[model samples]
Target: MGASQSDNAHLSKADVVSRIKTRLASADIKKAQEVGGIFLFNIIKGTTVYSWTLDLNKVEVFEGEPEDDPDTTFTLNEHYFKQLVYGKEDARTIMQAGRCSVTGDIMRAMKLEPYIKLN
Candidate 1:
C-alpha cells in the first residue's frame, strides 16, 4: 500500500524518510537532546511493526515497545504515514484525535510541530 514515483501526487515511506532526513540532516540530535522523545519510526518489518529512533547521528533501531515516554508518538499505518508525507492529513488534528500522542515534553514535541508537512 504505497504510491509510485510516477504518480507524483502521492507519497511513500521512502518519501517520508526523505522529508524527515532532509529536515534532520543538519539538526544536531545530541545538542537537541533536551528535546527527548522515543522518536518512533514505524516501518514494516515483514508484516510486523518495527520501531526505531532517528535522534541525531545515532540510529537506535530496535523491535517492540518504546522505552522512554516520548514527547509525541505517531501511531499511524504505513500508508497513512506516507499520506502525511504527501500532505493528505493535518498532523495537528491527528494528534488531537489521539492518533498521535504526546506524553511528556509536549512543548518539545510542539517545537517539531511546524516541521511536519502534512498537506
Candidate 2:
C-alpha cells in the first residue's frame, strides 16, 4: 500500500533520510549492491536544503552538499521527493514534467528504481 496522507504530511527531510538509510540497510536491498555507486540526493524544502548519499554498502545522510563527487545526482523539491518515495508520484511523470532533474550517469539513476521501489 502507498503511504497515507497523514504519514506523508509528518515526514521531514531528516525522516526521509532515515527511511532511506533503514531501507538500504535491509536484506531486501542486497540485490541493490549490484548496481550501486555514489548517489546524491539534493532535496530542497523552501529555503532549506538536505542531502544524502548512497554507495552500495552504506547510506549517509547530512545537511548541505556531499563531501565527495556523486556518481549520480537527483535534484527535486521535498514534496516530490516524498511523493516518489511513498509511491504517490511516478518518477517518469515527474521527470517528464521537468519537476525532477538528474545529472551524471542516467543508467545508474535508472538502476536505483528497483532499490527505491520506484519501478
Candidate 3:
C-alpha cells in the first residue's frame, strides 16, 4: 500500500468515477448482488455538485441520482471522494469528522467501501 502512495496521491475525482463506472459495469452481478441497495453520491467540486448512483440491486452504477430515495446518500467534496476511493480515508471516520455527510441507513454505508475502493 505504501509503495503506491504517489499514484493514489494525485488521484482525481474524475479518475475515481471513471474507474468505479467501469468496474461496476464489468463486475459479476451474482457476487455484487450480495451487497444490494441503492447508494447515492453527491460529489462537490467548487460551485458544481455532481450526483452518482450505485444501484447494487441492479448491479449498475450511473450518473445522476435514482428516481426514488436511495438506501444511503453520501455527500462529500471531490477531494475527499478521491481520497475515499483510494482508501486514503475511512468513510466512517470522514463522516464522524464532518468531512462527509451521510443520510439514511448509516450503518449500511460501510458496505459501500468495496464498491468504491480502487485497487
Top candidate (lDDT):
3
Off by over 4 Å in 3: 1-12
lDDT of 1 by residue, 1-119 (tens): 24543373444455556666666655655655555455555655247674544442252323444566444455566655555555666656666776654454555555553334433
**Where does model 1 exceed 4 Å of error?**
1-11, 26-38, 43-47, 56-71, 114-119
1 versus 3: better TM-score goes to? 3
Clashing pairs in 1: 87-119
Q: Each candidate's TM vs. the true structure?
A: 0.53, 0.81, 0.85
lDDT of 3 by residue, 1-119 (tens): 67686777666666667789888877778767887889999999899999989998898888889998899998999888887887878877788899999988887778777678886
Q: For all the candidates, what are their Cα RMSDs to the real structure? A: 5.4, 2.8, 2.2
TM-score, model 1 to reference = 0.53
Error of 2 at 8 (Å): 2.2
Candidate 2 regions off by >4 Å? 1-3, 28-30, 57-65, 117-119
Worst 10 residues of 1 by lDDT: 55-64
Q: Indicate the residue-level lDDT of 63 in model 1.
A: 40
For model 1, what is the alpha-carbon lDDT of residue 96? 76
